[model samples]
Target: MNSELEALNSLIMTEADGLLYEKGLIRKLEKYGDVFISGSYFLQLMTWRDLDIYLASDKMNEETFFELGKEVSLCIKPAKMNYRNEFIGHTEHLPKGYYWGCYADFNTNAWKVDVWAISSKEFEQKQQEIEKLKFQINVVQRMAILKLKNSVYNHPLYRKKFFSVDIYNAVIEDNVNSEEKFKYWLQIKRGLSLN
Candidate 1:
């Protein structure tokens, strides 16, 4: 990662440890399975961005799942909260998984936190796929992915249309640069739905 991203991540980590963990929010969610953090904030080699926290648990039910979501929302006191499931439709290009998530902003920090719940099976499968792709992604390919994601001025429309997974696929499998990948993204972006 670059210096800016590293510094931002360090500060975010400190806040998560001091505020979230100390407030018992992180501890309360420990029963949800091995927590894994993803998204641009953690992976991209660019400027700082939001956080994506996924809890892999097989015990999620309709009642407790939404209840846990409410708990997380209340604990974080985010500025916005949308607890919705986007996998019900648009199954073609979307990732194969069952999840309930909240997209929220805590303050005016140019960053947000997305807390979500996904099944253990789906989580494991996605992790394995990412692990296999990690070895194939060298510095050049990683830069390509980062550049493509940053091309859209970090717009929500761009992220929904051409997510990190889409960028990874284009960079690794198609071996396309940022421009080509972006053109392809524009071609298919309209068909996708925001989660």
Candidate 2:
């Protein structure tokens, strides 16, 4: 691993630990269901202050989920929190579950935490997918992903038009090795013009 990338990952993980452990976020979450920390944080490719947490429970209903959200709000004291009932109105490319998008200031840095309450089946499937990616990503691909992720962190098309998954596919599957190639790949493959 590149020293710079490793250093950044370590720093971000430390902050994440502060949120998950020091703030009792994980403990608070465990009261509701089994907690699984996923996305860039779990993959150790973090380039920004974003956390994706999934709670798996068979008995999670709207009321219970709202209760969980209330607990999370009190715990994080977020500046803003947006709730989404994806189970009722499922969005394409998003998990079929209840979502709580929390934006807060932690350790003097703005952070975004996405908490999803999903079924155990869905959680297992997602974990399988992540594990596959973990095995497929070699050191070269890892560095490429880290660099591309950092470069596109502030792109106009980021999150809204493209996502980290697209970057991962580009680097891992299409062998996109640089920001230039990724931009070209986006244009040709996804019809997304980054320029």
Encode model 2's per-residue lDDT on 136-162: one tens digit a residue: 999999999999998899987799889
TM-score of each: 0.69, 0.96
| TM accuracy, model 2 | 0.96
- Model 1 lDDT per residue over 153-189, tens place: 4567755556666667777877877665566655665
Backbone clashes in model 1: 0
Q: How far in Å is the alpha carbon of 23 misplaced in model 2?
A: 0.7
Please list all clashing residue pairs in model 2, or write none if there are none. Answer: none
In model 1, residue pairs whose N, Cα or C atoms come closer than 3 Å (at least 3 residues apart or on different chains), thus clashing, are none
lDDT of 1 at 158: 58
Top model number, lDDT: 2
lDDT of 2: 0.92
